[model samples]
Target: MKKIKIIILFTILLLPKLVFASNATIAITGVNTAAVGNNIKMYVTLSSSAAIGSWELTLNYDSSFLKLIGSDADNGGTFMANKVAGASGINKKVYTFTFRTLKAGNTLLSIGSSSLYDFDTMGEMTVRTYNKNLKIMTQQEIEASYSKDNYLKSLSVDEFEINPVFNKDTLEYSVEVPENTKTINIKAVANDNRSTIDGLGEKEVVVGNNKLNIVVRAQNGSERIYILNVNVIDKNPIEIIIDNVTYHLVKYKEYLTIPSGFEETTIKMSDIDIPAFYNKKINYTLVGLKDEAGNIYLYKYEKNKYERFLELKLGNLKLTPLSIGNKVLNYEKETIDFDGKIDVYKIDKRFKLINAKNILNGEEGLYLLDIVDKTAVKYDLKDIYTLRKLNKIYLATTIIFLSTTALSIIIMLSFKRKPKIKDKEQKVKEKTKKELPKDEKVVKENKKNK
Candidate 1:
């Protein structure tokens, strides 16, 4: 009994020494806080002063809040994997594991009973132990593709109405496109920050039905869908695009009225006139072109003709055409008749004669009329001025009259001074010829002095 007591005391001291002097240790290391829905890494290090043969450890964690992804048996480069035991073992061996945070909570992870076979000792060695904690947070959920926020079409024209199909708690809908639409645009919206969307947006509208599918993803990795069926109708068969503006052609259409641009002006539509025979017997097709600056041009074509016979540059024209047997049209109280041989055209706002700006633009309103059928032009505007032709003749007559009048005034002054001058000259000559004119010379001198 005394010997047993001595051995027991010695055993206690030996155990303390062994634990303190150990050259091998194991620790549980991982993130203390993990965000919800995020991945985390856990590590276990087996460090020894010397090489080891093998090691095995079982980690325990709260399974409710954490999901284990996988582990690297070989520590990704630090240790050798034990294939038979399905573990890692080596000097300085490290094991790494990945996990996902399932919910918002706190959890503890610890290393269970483990062993390390040391090559130098050729036996199992003891090592230290540790525990770790983790936490997950709750965040707002993601949302996508709200049915109330998604729209398949947006148009401003009042001619078409938008009425989607009504269903029982379903987001699917449909819309009808107006006829003669060459192109169309669509709009779709995602209403949540955490949501994602794909497979839906603006798309071209074909002549038939167009299918629209929009996918929405939430923060929780859930998906929803919004489907739209758009029906596009067939438009007028004869359509044309000029300067980005579209015009429709109608049957038996002779003249297209271009509304006046100015709100108030003295120019009345009846004030303008086109010849009755302009479009009497021939067919006429009319189309309009608009530029970015708001200038409108009308292209006139003969019936059954593809090419344009006339293009109005500016302003507009009004032609009250009289058809065959049709009453003579009244224009400014003037009688006119349509021979039914050619169609008469009336321009509204784009008449170059009414709008002088067309002249600056180098545009002629009657250019089309000149090229079509060699039709004769009755009259045109001529500039007027006063005395333009008689200016040179008037200037010459004035110069000749002024010269003759000056000569007559000079002759009259010379005749009035001639008598006095001749009397004085005769006295001087008689006194110079006679020597006994001393007294007369003195008297002449006195007269001259006076």
Candidate 2:
């Protein structure tokens, strides 16, 4: 009967102490598994039966296997050695910590000396701590369970509908938008959570057809592509003609930048408004022209005149010559080798063929303009013409001298063939003797002897 009375007395004395024990809890929650080099996030949550006014704790983790990069504790500041208060009337608080996995290893996240205070009384309360275990694996180890699903579960565009609806097996879709639309938003959800999708989000569109592609990469190293053929309508288009071929003005002017010393303006072409840039000092206007083959080129425009704009740079010298026609100068393009191809131009057929000319000094002549190398070499046309003339004069002079010498030799031979004065007198005497016969011959011989 005495032992029973002592047991009753002991139970009655311990009942109040058991009732005063804390009902607060603190636990860490996150993905327990991560691949090396990847980032992982963990949350530290604190809850209590009573409102939590404030709390302080030290988070501990292995620095070798993980590196803490960021945290959302204490208002984005470092959570170490700091006391933070919960929001008003809130009994629960969650803090996030981001870490980058370093290598293949296991790590634990625990807290130390954590004290929770009551919201009303500000009295410290006892709390239970729960640690979390994280396992980091190598890339090869994680690949064993990789899923091979490289397809999208759903595809959509913001404020636009895809034609023929969206199907996982259908890789191509066509969407049409108004000409004024500048951008389109794309949303693609992967079929599997392990798959990654690229080429999503907002993309700029042009006035014509725009081709966009989305690529899905499965965890097991496989890929699938989805194409979007987006066509933008052109309303009130501006058209122009060049070289007897028709072209349209580029409606999207955001891509082009106005040149220095030029102001934005608009011009009328084919009775339609066209955007252009103009400079009053130079009286030059530039516009973007698009060919039928979907190629864009800048053109110089004037009063009812248009030509392809060409600018050449050679070292410190820059030249903006008059309209150089597409017809290449065929007279002597290959005469002087510029070590590569040369663009020879003739402003007019009646003038000399030239590659470049100094507009400032009026030094107009032939030059080997190497556009790729940005080099120029001048050729002296005057010297070449002078040498040609000298050669012709030399040939003519030699011909005249040879003809005069041959004429003099012919005249001298004719004079030498004629008889001299003594030979003429001897010939006359002989003739007379033959005429006188034998009697006259004897009388002449006796007289010569005397």
Candidate 3:
């Protein structure tokens, strides 16, 4: 009797702890100290020796001191970490609550409500939570400094804005400048207070790239470099000198005058006829012209004729000279025109063939053409005899066929069959039920008999 009384008393005393131990718990697990507007994460975990099927957690914070930003299950992940469980229950599952300090004050982060279920899927016990207090401090003000902050804040020249570019957290700066600007005055400033910046003045730029180095020295003698990747693009390249003589480049409105000896690049030209007609001094563009020989010429249009503009040696090209006189001008620099006295010109490779074909339709005519494209040129001569004979034969055949058709039509019209006079055959009109319904003596449908 004495041992039974002692055992019952012990069971009664240990019943509360055993029951409370299985109850769910909640806590704010983050840094105790926080700055103003700093965010803190709080965890509310419900754990029981039994398996958990599902749960819902809720937190209430002091609205005056802290502002609740967000609440999530395991920081925006799924509620269940390993959905397929090997064991019967989850060991620990956390519910996250994020809050930001609104004012520099202490706030109590408490679990206002929570519910949990075991593997049996029943909420039988009351849930308990541990409350937490957060100490939030005022935010520290950022001090203005020369070296510590953003380097190369503002880069500019007189009346011109130079965009200084740098990689994130990089100390170097690079900029591109106009070509016409020979000397540029750059203004640069540092954000750090104690730092001193050197080489922030006038810099002479070369034709291509001009590299300028700026040194930033802080008060502690810590040196940093703000490299100026200054790219001074070369100006519109005007004159190019060959040997000692500098050939001045003359610019017209559209095209450019290519130098005689050297090569040049300019806007593409079209519409103008090559092998110009006469030496009429037209106020044409002072641009250059190129021939088949790859010779670029710049000359006054008044002194320029079709062939006299440039001396092109058509090496493999078949060119027919306009005149083949006794002079026999071999390796000629000046090109001759079609002879007006004799109207006869020799054909060499295949230039200016007077009777070239318009290969599209086989019509022969004179057409200026690009040597690279020879589709329009005549490759085979047309057979005139065969064409004429074929035409005569076709005309005779057509005339004979038409005559025979006309005779046949006339004979058929004359021997046509005359219609017999018994053509008035009449069709009978049948009376319907409406016409017969007036009288009672009418045949009825035999539906009943059938």
Candidate 4:
């Protein structure tokens, strides 16, 4: 009973320490499992009641079973734990652990603290097992699976439907699983003689079961020989529409056929006539027929006349005289009658009159006389005559006006006389001579008295 009491006391003392020590809970939210070469990320949250001085985490796992391909811990550090001092004021600590998978299979991982000599604490917590699987099937395995199932023979595509097809060039098949199925795995392959023009390939797709319309296009131009094998929980038929045409698509496979009554005709144009100066070429409307499966086959119309124009080279005619004295004259010189003679006068004063009857018979020219009446009507150059008459009148009026004005000016300048002013000495001398001549007798008397 005394020993039992001692054990109880010791347990009581350890309980408080265990409760006060930091406890951690780790969980993976996004992806729990990773493929052979893929990465796995987990969120680590540590909870504690008492302040942690410094702590370290040691990750324990089977290296042989799983290899750590890569990791992004605190600064690319190794998977070993180091001092993680608890944050001030906050009682919990959290960290993220990201790692890549090198090998496959389940790996038992444990994250715990080292043995504490000075302080009593909880060591570590053992989390759940992490199971990793292979990434995907190889191209050869996918091809073989597709061949065995005869998926190629049963494959068919619809318009506007998203479906996985085999890519011969890349040797890969991509498929999306429907939402209704819990899980789905798909494999595909293609084999055709025109593999050079078309591609050949195989692929594997794995997805969770869901009712979703999956879209798969053949990469590397391998749409011709597409074969696919689908293992789905729900075996409902899938519908796909290609090129706006509808088709009943099966989950596993179906054959695609060009609908019946679908005839395609092409009209080849051997020659086409178009106006050279036309701005735009004629656009021919294409006519064709299509089936419910949305296959477009084109037909063209027969070539017809595109344009037309008159076939004539029109030009302007300019006539010039080669010789002088090309007098197109007539008896009535004013009018050169149609039967007139075109007198060709030479520079030697001799004239040769050629009957212009031929040239003037149908030609047109200016006429100075009325040929029909045979009347002689003087043809006057109105402007020249008027100007000459005006000049003569103006000259006569100017001469008469100028002569009269000159005579009047000369008569006024010569006949208009002004009296000259006499000098004061001459007036005085004349007065003295008059007075002396009247006193001649007294002068003689006076001289006799002197």
Question: Evaluated with TM-score, which candidate comes out highest?
Answer: 2
> What is the per-residue lDDT of model 4 for residues 113-168, given as tens digits with 9 covering 90 to 100?
43221122434332232222333333443344332221232223221122454333
**Model 2 global lDDT (CA atoms, 0 to 1):** 0.74
Residues 1-450, model 2: lDDT tens digits: 999999999999988743343457889999978999999998888888887777787778889998888897765543533344555545787888999999998888888678887766667778888999998999888887688899999999999999869999999998999988779999989999989999899988766667788999999989999998777787776678888987778766774566555688887666766778876655668998866544566678877678765444556544444423444534443232232223455433333344454533435456645545666556676776898899999999999999999999999988886767668999999998888788777999999999
Query: What does candidate 4 score on TM?
Result: 0.25
Give residue 434's lDDT in candidate 4 (0 to 100): 87
Q: Best candidate per lDDT, number?
A: 2
- For all predicted structures, in order, the TM-scores are 0.25, 0.45, 0.25, 0.25
Candidate 4, residue 319: the lDDT equals 14
Give the clashing pairs for model 3: 145-191, 145-192, 145-193, 146-191, 146-192, 146-193, 147-192, 281-302, 318-349
2 or 4, which is superior by TM-score? 2
The lDDT of each candidate is: 0.50, 0.74, 0.50, 0.36
Off by over 4 Å in 4: 1-23, 27-54, 69-105, 114-280, 283-288, 295-450
In model 1, the runs with Cα more than 4 Å from the true position are: 1-22, 74-89, 140-450
lDDT per residue as tens, model 1, 250-351: 211122343222111111113332211123223333343323222233444344332322322323433322222222112112121222223333332221
